[model samples]
Target: MNRKNKIPKFIFYMIALWTIFSTAHAEEIMPKAFVYTEVQNSVPFDQIPWKSRNPIISSQPGFISKTWLSGSGNNSVGGIYSFDSIENAKKYVTKFFPNAVKKQGVAHTSRIFDAVIVEKASRDIGSAHFGGKISTKPGAFVYTEIQVNLPFKNVPWQQRNPIIKKIPGLLSKTWLSGVNNTVGGFYAFDTLENAKQFAIEVFPKTAAKMNAALYTRIFDARLVEHASRGMDSPFFQ
Candidate 1:
């Protein structure tokens, strides 16, 4: 080989080392992952033996916190959860969680979100888990997601704020956007009745206006506070 064509040994080693360091740094800063799930046509929240499973769930890889949600009307049950990383979030949703619920529910749905990216927008709406505090009074929670064509950055979070603020009994909301152009939020409300009204009668209309498919559920926040606190939920703290 011609001497002129040869690369310097030091330069080559420097580039190699930099590449390795950069990759690891990126992973370190990767955002926390969020997961939401619902089991349809299931038994009432009181009947489900979630206490037996809390210890097992806390033991999962990358698990951080979780808040159980009971459906306002359908006897459905689900949870709003957080994890240390996106990979673990998807793993639980696709593999572990599904299998765990199979005996009790044949139909279930789940979505994973990138929590860090939307932190600012979520906070704007009173996301207690992010930094705000949930109402001291008992409350219910709502989860809603819609399909969209726009990228996450392009979604108009500000424009939707006015509409959401008008919701009666609303205390706070944490916005969410995830892989495959999904938009959604976790909402806290002062009363179960108001949450049911929004989930069943209000949010669907909003989704239709956006021309996107909607997925939503209402959970009894008060019922699950203890289990959630046990899992290190930020809201409880």
Candidate 2:
């Protein structure tokens, strides 16, 4: 289809904006963004400017780790935030996020969810892990927000992993699906072009074959910081 969502020309501007600072321990995985219905007591706060002026979000209760996207248009705003537990994750969205927006003064609307990490992989293009060395440079990734048919079934990881392993330039893929059945994945690529190419070439056929109702968004993602116990290369369809 030759689809394109170009990163802003002001490249460095995005590098400055997409930043995530977090800490994690092994054996910790929690829910996805569960749209918080209640306003988390905004109670008077500071206003944060746009990207390039991201407020330093420190580690706190429920805060485990996160992945952020920079840029506009093709750029995304929210991120994958892991918490101590599903309850803790929900609390953060209902409590922390409202206040965060108030103090940061950033316009954001969150659809909270509690998702489980069904699979994680490091495409073999490079060592893609949950946690790794920190870097601020802009990187590219695409994650899908989808709904799958009941009795979800697809090609076994044993078979799919081999296929993805052969594709060139995939950094990593973290599969997450909400309890409500929202399915998607977090992926990192060497370039935005590569990410889009992957979205068009691989996802369509695979998802249809699996009967998964899916859609994808490519973004300028960054891995500011993380803590991992080991590497997971399971390819989830």
Per-residue lDDT of 36 in model 1: 89
Q: Write the per-residue lDDT of candidate 2 for residues 1-237, one digit (tens) a residue.
A: 223234454554666554321222243432233232222222211221223323343244655445444432423355545554667666666677777667755456554444333433322222233343223232566666556633113414446566765655665655554545555566667676777788878788778976767767666543321211111111110
Model 2 per-residue lDDT at 73:
42
For candidate 1, lDDT tens digit of each residue in 36-152? 888766577777677788899888888877877777667787888887788999999998988987976478888899887887787777776676676664478888888775566
**The candidate that achieves the highest lDDT relative to the unseen native structure:** 1
The reply for model 1, stretches above 4 Å from the true place, is 1-31
Q: In lDDT terms, how accurate is model 1?
A: 0.79
lDDT of each: 0.79, 0.47
Error of 1 at 132 (Å): 1.1
